[model samples]
Target chain A: MTVQTWTYILVGITFALYIGIAIWSRAGSTKEFYVAGGGVSPLANGMATAADWMSAASFISMAGIIAFAGYDGSVYLMGWTGGYVLLALLLAPYLRKFGKFTVPDFIGDRYYSKTARIVAVFCALIVSFTYVAGQMRGVGLVFSRFLEVDINTGVIIGMIIVLFYAVLGGMKGITYTQVAQYCVLIFAFMVPAIFISIQMTGNPIPQLGMGSTLNDGSGMYLLDKLDGLSTELGFNEYTDGSKSVTDVFMITLALMVGTAGLPHVIVRFFTVKRVKDARKSAGWALLLIAILYTTAPAVSVFARTNMINTVSDQEYASMPAWFKTWEKTKLITFEDKNGDGKIQYVADAKQNELTVDNDIMVLANPEIANLPSWVIALVAAGALAAALSTAAGLLLVISASVSHDLIKKVFKPDISEKGELLAARLSAVVAVVIAGYFGINPPGFVAAVVALAFGLAAASFFPAIVLGIFYKKMNKEGAIAGMVIGISLMIFYMLKFKFGIFDGGKSAVAGLQKDWWFGISPEGFGSIAMLVNFVVSIVILQFTPAPPEDVQEIVEDIRIPSGAGQAVDH
Target chain B: MSDKQKKASAYWRENVRYLFLLLSIWFAVSYGAGILFKEALDTIQIGGFKLGFWFAQQGAIYVFVILIFVYVRLMNKLDKKYGYNE
Candidate 1:
């Protein structure tokens, strides 16, 4: 069969599996809908959490980014994984002990104010929506390239598929489906990696191969050769640091804090039965995540080396079929700026007329390597699985925030369970549709805002949740004020430098290019914003009324592991 | 305070201590070797890769996975000691 036929078969089988799981695990009550009835085993929950957290960003784009950025890419590798440490140690167990379905539930009840819950609900919606928009766009991007569907039509199809399962099974459906997705995606990712690793370095393990000698008779080390090639092309050393030390420090910190505080991931811990399971589940999630996270760098190195060898100094007419195919797709382009027939991939923009989008590095790697048609098909399915799994998780967070947190808890306390569940499902439909629309006609700066979603969460939620768990004296006023100040600062900085809003919307300035505060970009500013949040909360708490006695009692209870009462169905 | 409260407090204190120990290792491997002292560490080589690069992209992640399991074990034992184990 042809490659397109294989792609259809693979994606079809996976979607069918997800829909089947959704039907079997259809949520019976709000408990099942929200937290899978709090019965998921640690291992399965771990797999689901890994799938929910990885997203299309990690699956499709991370290796591509790493391929070009070289050692500077370590920030993503460390930041994304290291956050689980903070989650497992500082946050997850306590949140599970709190026995709640959503992050907003914790803030609302713990702060003992409907106003606080409302504030948290707003934050959750904003963070989740920003994140889901990226996932929807990812789905559209994959479908358009492989399935021959228009980006908008692909988004509508994705929305319909998600609406069917998510509206029916809610968190339960999403969880089981994610577990299946994790398996498919990891397998798909590893197959091509193993083939390439062996082909290049005579080692099947990509991680070791990354640090191993090349199979080529030159006896040169892989990284050493990559470094030599990079310098020859006017690029920074592939294995040495290029980014500012301070910026790397801050970006990694921001991503870590943001990962811990994301509502979708934190809510995964709510599915397990006991506090100990929350701790164990975190370990499971990280281990599963590490499988892909570690392999990504190896993939990066492989793609980089392969690409440099294939195109650099090679005649544009004699370039490989993959090159021509990608060129047709406009993912890879060559302009003989110097009137040389040979395509030169170099760091100098004037002579370097070969433009390759970083995102294509991962997607096109299989084709570039001449891998079988089945392997390419598997990758298409894996990308879809990654996008869909994350979109489903994010939509649930939006649904729960609107129906359970805002509408039921804050606005109408008298709503029946049946009414609330219907509300949750209905809101999920609306949320998925809205996310789909944004995926098609992605709003101006949606990509920019997506970058800041982590910053916003890191700035806003991480400190609030951490303090609520650890600080007994944290009053509602301090939490609310800190969240506001934290998120606002992040947005203001992103606009000022990234979009040039502060400079009359020129979007570029002569002298203002490198004029960042302490050399910190908007991506790195979250760690600073988070620190400010902590300080603001503490200083304000000194004068504010202390948390109520019952709130302190609840905090004390969450601190212990013994009586993690079964998650309440409500 | 009750005797049980004292025991629970001690357990909590021990848990925090273990976290401190493990997280210190975490910081040393990633932020320390991967960034601050990367140049110093790069003078050393592992297989074909620079030691610092290995730590950044590979070693730190391995250590993080190990650290979580260690924390899990410590917390579980602490829970059992304080009569908080399920």
Candidate 2:
């Protein structure tokens, strides 16, 4: 059967399964909507959390990005995973002990101030929207490539699917659906990787295969061969990094902090039954995530080597069928520069006639190696599962923040549970539409926007939540001031450096990197902003009176893990 | 302070100590070996992998998973020791 037929069968079955789960798990009350009735088992929550955490960026773009960045990509490998350490140790259990439905609930209640909650709500929205936009775009990309649908149409289909599960079943439906998604995505990612690993190095394990000798009878290590091939094509050795050590350090720190702070990820802990479960679930989530994370770099190496060998300096007419298929999608193009039909996949921009989108490396890997059509089709289903699961999680966060934090908590404190549930569903629909618009007309590359989301979360949420939990003296005045300053500084730096808004717009962004603050890129500037938040909060706290005695008591209460009741609504 | 309060504080202190120790290991592996000392460690290779590169891309991740599980065990034991276990 053709790849498209297999894709239709697989994608259709997965979507049907997700919808079935949503129908079966329809949330009946606000508790179910927000925290899945606060009774999710640790193992199930762990699977759901893993699916929620690994977005399109991790599933689709990361390996491709790493292939191009080479050793410099270690920032993502270390930065993204290491954050789970922060989440598991510093945040998850305590937050679970606090027993809240949303991040703003802790901030508002702990600080004993409405302003602090509002600031948290604002940051949550910004962070979630940026992150979700990337997920929607990922959905659109998969649909457009595999199903031959327009990107906008794909986004609309995605929005409808997410809206169905999210509005109907809320966290309950999303949780069970995500468990299914985790299975689909992990299975899909590993099958091709293992296939390619065995084919390339005669080893079944991708992680070990990456270090083993090539199977071509050359008796050369895979990395050694890749490095040799890379330099021969005027590229840096694949094992060496070109980014400055300081930048890599700061960027890694920012991503780690940000991952710990992301509202959607942190909120997943609220669904579990106990503080101990929260801690255990974080372990399971990271372990599940590591299965894919550890294998990504190895896949990048395999795909990069395969791509360079197949297309570099090869005649365009003899290019494989997958090349032609991808070419029609406009993701891979060859201009036949120098009046020759040979493809020049080179380091120099002026002479390089082929432009391949980073996404193609993973999406086309199975086809490049002549893997069966079913395997290729499975990747499509997996990418959709990944993109949709994360999109639903972020959408839930956005909707919950608006419905629970703003409307229910602040604007209409007397709103009914039924009214609040309605508001949540309505907010989700609006959020999905906005997200689909961004997907159809993306602001930038999916990964870059997602990285900035992490930076935003790191800058604003991490410090406030940490201080709120760890320090009984963390007053509302201090927390509010710190969050405002930290988020504002991060936004200013991102606009100036990432978008070049201050220097005349997107065109100036290229030249603005040289003027980065202290040589820190906008992506890494979160660490600096987070530092400022900690300092500003501490300084402000010295002048302000300590938090009221009751608030301090609440802090002491959360520190103990024995009696973490169901996530409280009021 | 009451006996309960004292016990809670003791548990908190122990948790902080564990966090400090485990996080130090986390930092040493990822930030230390993976980035700062990567070049120096690249001089040494394991199998077909450079030590630093392996840490950056592979080794650090394995260690992170282990560290979290370690923290989970320590925290659970501390809860039981302090009579906070459910």
Per-candidate clashes, comma-separated: 0, 0
Ten contiguous residues minimizing lDDT sum, candidate 2 chain B: B74-83
> Model 1, range A490-522, lDDT digits (tens) per residue?
888888877888787744743465898998878
Query: Of the candidates shown, which would achieve the greatest lDDT relative to the real structure?
Result: 2
Tell me the tens digit of each residue's lDDT in model 2 across A494-551: 9899888889988999999899989999989999999999999999999999999999
- Candidate 1 lDDT score relative to the true structure: 0.90
The local lDDT score (0 to 100) that residue A102 gets in candidate 2 is 97
Cα-based lDDT for every prediction:
0.90, 0.94
- Candidate 1 clashing pairs? none
Cα deviation of B20, candidate 2, in Å: 0.5
Q: What's model 1's TM-score?
A: 0.98
RMSD to the true structure for each prediction, in A, is: 1.2, 1.0
Clashing pairs in 2: none
Which stretch of 10 consecutive residues in model 2 chain A shows the poorest summed lDDT?
A: A443-452
DockQ for every model comes to 0.88, 0.94
